[model samples]
Target: MSSADAFQQLVEETLLANAAVVALVNNRVYEAPPPKGARVFPDVTFGPADSDDADADCIDGVEHVLQLDVWAQDYGRLSSAKRIADAIRKALHRADLALPDPYALALIEVASIRAFQDPDGLTAHAVISVRSIIETET
Candidate 1:
């Protein structure tokens, strides 16, 4: 399967399988449609924790960072963190995308997911983080 397609599938399956994520409380996963308007920040920078390797290149050329502005209408951080991480890990590992080393994969961070409620229903805005090395040749 294609990388994007695998990413979507991984998100769905991993979240569904999470034990902490109960069905009744937070069952559904909402995603923005294709060509999501948010700007993707490619070539994100990373540095070693304690090393001053300013010249060290942790990632190869054109590191990719895809930002999809998604709404989790029913789930909260307590139930979604593990699932989200799993989804990212699985998707990044899929053959379609460059295979990132398992050790290199890390949870960068997650922004505060605020509850967004309206007449339609309730939702939350989340900024999911993922760390990956650009294994593909430039």
Candidate 2:
């Protein structure tokens, strides 16, 4: 698999393993939309990934900038969405993720987080930016 794909899988697995996150999203995490009300209040989505080379002479590595989005219909106060964002940060920040075979996750860091009310007014949205370093197995 590509480094980006491996890193993404690691992230999804980490979030799925977090009990607090599961309680909120109920594993309704995906790259695409799930059916409405298929799970719970807040759902997590993995957004786009931007990658660049972090390669060295002997080691081939990649740095990936990934986004995670949280959505909820909490109206005025987006407490639930905020909490879910926090959980995502906790799950990924400075984490040592494990990638699929032939790839190794060197590090993962939460770069930034932005939360805002969507134009629709009813949905609260949180976007999390994460950076990850992955190295190919020799």
Candidate 3:
């Protein structure tokens, strides 16, 4: 599996998990570097997945898999990685879904949360990977 594949899968899972949240918010938003208050965030985009990569199946014989890659712009400056993961989990659980086993989807792992000092000051980014397998009842 490549980074792009992993990233797309994570994206799909997150959307599914937070369908309700998305509907309520009216727009998608990522946590951005705070200058205290900024009405609009800078233009940011999630690049497309690599052309050659493809999605993968779950080891437990799951048919469908959903994966998500979430990150803040200024990574590794502030914020706790675990807290970010918890936030992602909460977002997912709110829609009545749960993340799958980590071992099943091994792509971009949440190694750590770090802070970077920009010219403006210090900023934080929380990169997270989440997955959910589509299980069938036998």
Best candidate, TM-score: 2
lDDT of 1 by residue, 1-138 (tens): 333333344444554565543332244444433254542211111111111111236533222333433344343332343344334344333323323332222222222222223344433343444322233222
Regions of model 1 farther than 4 Å from truth: 25-27, 30-58, 61-108, 119-138
Could you give candidate 2's per-residue lDDT for residues 15-87 as a string of tens digits? 9999888888888788777676565557888898899989988988889999999988878467888999998
lDDT of each: 0.34, 0.86, 0.37
Model 3 earns a TM-score of: 0.32
After superposing all C-alphas onto the true structure, candidate 2 shows an RMSD in angstroms of 1.8
Candidates 1 and 2 compared by TM-score, better number = 2
Best by lDDT: 2
TM-score of each: 0.34, 0.90, 0.32
lDDT against true structure, model 1: 0.34
